[model samples]
Target: MKRKPPTISPEDSELFRDAIGDVRRIEAEPAAPARPGPPPEPRRLRIDEEEALRESRRAPADLALDAADLLSYCRPGLPERVFRQLKRGEYSIQDEIDLHHLRAADAEALLKQFLNAARRGHHPCVRIVHGKGLRSEGAPVLKSLVDRVLRHRGDVLAFASAPLNQGGSGAVLVLLDER
Candidate 1:
């Protein structure tokens, strides 16, 4: 049978408003704070894509060569050719990883990526951002699992926490073996 819905009493509505006198009506209000100024232009670091490919092709062991060694390949007076070459975005590719919301079910995916990178003959290094467990109810799970995986992972060479500019103690720089 069709029936009309009961109507809320006008007195009840008046009582509700009186009870919430100071509280603003959220549904009819400005969503965000007023902006002080226009947004700034974006900046990007110069990157050499070709050199990056060649750098990735070089065997992982070759990366151990110090700046003194690159001096033999390049011209003289280049004090930090090794580090410069790496930062050119050619030989060493840097990527950020977030474990903030990673599930236990996704560990296999991480393993697969590690194995694939090793097989490609690249000195693949990645920044894994496992945030401090401040918001988590228990101990940090992703960092713990990553540590366990590294223990048994053949492709892993070594891993260490990054410096302050590189995600600080919250992230790790992982060095993978040759593919």
Candidate 2:
């Protein structure tokens, strides 16, 4: 059931209008339809950039290895020829990472990320420039970090000090297991 609206007396209406000054009617204009704006920024990428900045600002770790020591490694089942090829830089480097002056933790994180990306992309060969520790207080921290990291990763088939022209003992050319 519906109830009728309450009726107002003409005297009351007249008294209420009289109490307030007369007002002009509002002529509303039609509003334009809303258009979508640009897409939101990539928050994850921005966070990664911030983290990289923080890592860069931190002090270098004390980890060290001799600057002149050559870095080399080969998984047990890999053919001798394959290891030789890696050592001689036979395979073209598809990508590379440089840990020149990075702190140990930062270098390790970047190394892992770089290798994962390489493996996912099926990049068979890559290079890493860890920098000879000539300027380091004790030894080459980045070089040692790279050596240890590459050795432990399952996707790394082999790695060795890059050829003299490529960077000699300061860098290593990596052979990644194809995905």
Candidate 3:
């Protein structure tokens, strides 16, 4: 009963046909290398682990003490007698550690902990391993840092580099305050 689409004008019909053909061609084209889909699954977050890792990353100080600044005061000019005394452990020293394997991140906390503990126990001396810093970059990081930390700590009375027999210049013996 319809009147043949009401006689769509030749131009209009041609345009409509062209559009249909174009759409058909597009749909028939090889599906674009199977466009990559979303990731397989939702990522799981480890809240506690992330928090612990973040806390660990925080440096010991808000204002990082420059290594050079630490060096200016932590001189290696301790006397040989002091070195000998440290080796003999004649001054109520608690621990003589060989810090060869300690990582840089750990050295300060260990030093502070040891000093704090020794102070409480009325311990007089302790030995530290600076390891000559031959492998470390820029003026032996551990030795310099340790020196600065010790000099700044109230518990330390004195510290000197060791003699050849006792870790040579690679180590230092620290005398802690009896308080």
Top-lDDT candidate index: 2
Candidate 1 residue-wise lDDT, 1-179, digit = tens:
99999988999989998988877555776679877897643221013223333543452532332211111122234346543433332334445557677674485366446545543646466666665545545555555555444434545555655555665556656665553
List the candidates' TM-scores in order.
Answer: 0.43, 0.64, 0.49
Candidate 3: tens digits of C-alpha lDDT, residues 1-179: 76664778999989998877854334565656777888654122234334434654563544433322312222256566764565554555476766566776687667666666666676676667767776775567677667656656644557766555665567677786564
Model 3 lowest lDDT segment of ten: 66-75
lDDT of 3: 0.60
Error of 2 at 53 (Å): 23
Ranking by lDDT: 2, 3, 1
> In angstroms, how far off is 12's CA in candidate 3?
99
**If ranked by TM-score, best first, what sequence of candidates would result?**
2, 3, 1
Per-model lDDT: 0.50, 0.82, 0.60
Report the number of backbone clashes for model 3: 0
lDDT of 2 by residue, 5-103 (tens): 999999989999998979899999999999999887756545654665465446355434689999988999999999998898889999988887788
TM-score, cand. 2 vs. native: 0.64
**Candidate achieving the largest TM-score:** 2
